[model samples]
Target chain A: MSGISLSTTSYRNVSIVLFTLLVVTLVLAELHLGPLAWVAALVIACAKTVLVAVYFMHLRFATPLTRVFALAGVVWYVILLGLTLGDVLTRAH
Target chain B: MTHLAIAPQFDDAAQQHESAALGMWAFLATEVLFFGGLLTVYTVYRMAHPAAFAEASSHLYTWIGAVNTVVLLLSSWTMALAVHAGAHGERARIIRMLAATMALGLAFLLLKAVEYYLDFHDHLVPGRAFRPDWSTNAPAAQMFFILYFILTGMHAAHMLVGVLVVACFVAVIRTTPSPARHANALELVGLYWHFVDIVWIFLFPLLYLVA
Candidate 1:
C-alpha cells in the first residue's frame, strides 16, 4: 500500500515537471530565436517523449527485452532520417 | 493466484502479461515507422524550403496547438493514473481515471475541429482553394499546409480510435467481474495512449513552432 501511494506521488511529480517543460518550450517558441529555437524545441520535445515513455508508459519498470523492443522503433527511425537527410544535405543542387 | 483466467496457451499469468506487453511494444514499434515516414517527408521538405515552411507554420493557430498539447499531456497523466489504479486493484479509481482520460481526448478532438474550421476559413487547406499569399514561395507554402493537414488529420484519427477503445474497455470493466484481472489489458491500452501522446508532443513543436 505504501509503495502504491509513493508511486502515485511520483506520477504527480512527473506530471508537474512535464507541464513546466511544456511552458518553457512555449515561451521559447514565442521568442523566435531562429534556428536555435528549432534545436531547443526538438530537444525539449525529445525530453518530454522520454519522460512519458519512461514514467507514464512504465518503460522504466519494463523488462530489458521490452525496453530494447521499444527502442528498436526509434533506432530504425534515426537510421531512416539520417540516411535520407544525408542524401538531401550532400546533394549538389 | 487463480483469479486470472489465463489462456490455455500461456503457462501462467506472468507469462501472459509479459507476452502481451512484448506484443504491444512490437506493434508500437511498427507504428513508430508508420508515423516516422511522414515525419521524414516533412523534415526533408522543411530542410529544403526552410523559409517557406517557417512562414507557412506561422499561419497555424499556435494557441490552439499549445492548448491541445496540454490537453494530450493531461490525458496521458490520467491514463497513467488509470493504469496505476488498475495495478492496485482499485477498480473504481481505474474507471474514473479512464473516463477522465477519454474526456480529455474528446476535448482535444473538439479543439482540433475548431482549429480545422478556422483553417478552412483562413483558406489554409491545401488545394486550389489554398491561399498562398502567406509566403513568398507559394508552392512550398502550400506543401507545408498539405503536410500540416496530413499529420494532424492522422493524429486526430488515432485519438478517435483511442477514445473508442477506452470506452469499450470502460464498458467491459463495468459489466464484468474482477476488473483487477484486467490490469494487463489496461496497461496495454495505456501504452497505446501514451504513444499517441508522444507523437503529438513532437508534432506540436514541429508544426507550430516552425518560425
Candidate 2:
C-alpha cells in the first residue's frame, strides 16, 4: 500500500471531526464576540485547513520533502500578510 | 499483484508516483500564492474599512454561504475516498466516488448561481448598478462588494474547472484497462480539488461572517 493511502474508516473519522469543527466555527460566528469572534473564526479556519491538508490531501503520509514544500506556500503567505498588515496597521493617522 | 508499467524516466511505480506527487505539490504551492495575494488585498482593505466591510458582509446570505461550505467539504471528502479506492484498484468504487464528488461540485455551483442571482437582484455588483442599502459609507461598502465578487467569482471559476476535469477523468477511467495505474493521477487531482476547498474554507469566514 502507498504511504498516502488511508483506510475508509479513517477517512470517515476525519470527515466527522471536520464537520464538528465546522459547526463550532459557525456557532462562534453567531456569538458575535467582537474582535474575538474574528479571531476565533480565523483560528478555527486554520485548524480546518490543517485537517484537510493533512488527511484529505494526504500531507501527513507525504514524504518530509513534500511536507516542507507544502509548508513553504503557507509560510510565505503568512509573511506576505504579516508584513503588509504590520505596515498598514502601524501607519500614523 | 498487477504489475505497473514503469515509464522510461522512472525506475519503478513508487518513483513515478512520488515525482508526480511532488510536481503536483509544487503546482499547489504556486496556487497557494495565487489565492494568497487576493486574500492579502482583502485583508488590507478590510482593515482600512472595517465598518464598511462589516456592513457589507451583513447583507450577504450567510445561510447560502454556510450550506455551500458544507457542500464543498462533503465533495472533498468524496474526492478523498475516490483516491483511496483508486489505490486499492477498485475501479467501480473509484468511479462511484468521483461521480459523487462531481455531483457535489455541481450542487455547489448551483447554489452559488442562486447566490449570485440574489446578489444581482440586490444591486451588489459594484458598478453603476451598485446601490448598497447601508446608511453610511456607501463607497467603502462598494469596495467590500468588489472584493466579494472577485474572490467568490474566482473561487467559482475554480469549481467550474474542477467539475470539468473530474467529469473528463471519470469518462477516461471508465474506459481505461487498468484504473489502478492512474492512482497517482487521481491523487494529484484530489490535491487540486482539496486545495480549492481549503480556499473556500477561509473565504467563507472572511466574506460572509465578518459582521
Best by lDDT: 1
On a 0 to 100 scale, what is the lDDT of residue A33 in model 1?
Answer: 97
Q: Provide the overall lDDT of each model, using Cα atoms, as 2-decimal numbers.
A: 0.90, 0.89
Among incorrect, acceptable, medium and high, the docking class of model 2 is: medium
Write down the lDDT that model 2 would get: 0.89
Clash counts per candidate, in order, are 0, 0
Worst 10 residues of 1 chain B by lDDT: B1-10
Docking class of 1: medium
TM-score of 2: 0.97
lDDT of 2 at B147: 89
- What TM-score would candidate 1 get against the native? 0.96
> What DockQ does predicted model 2 obtain?
0.73
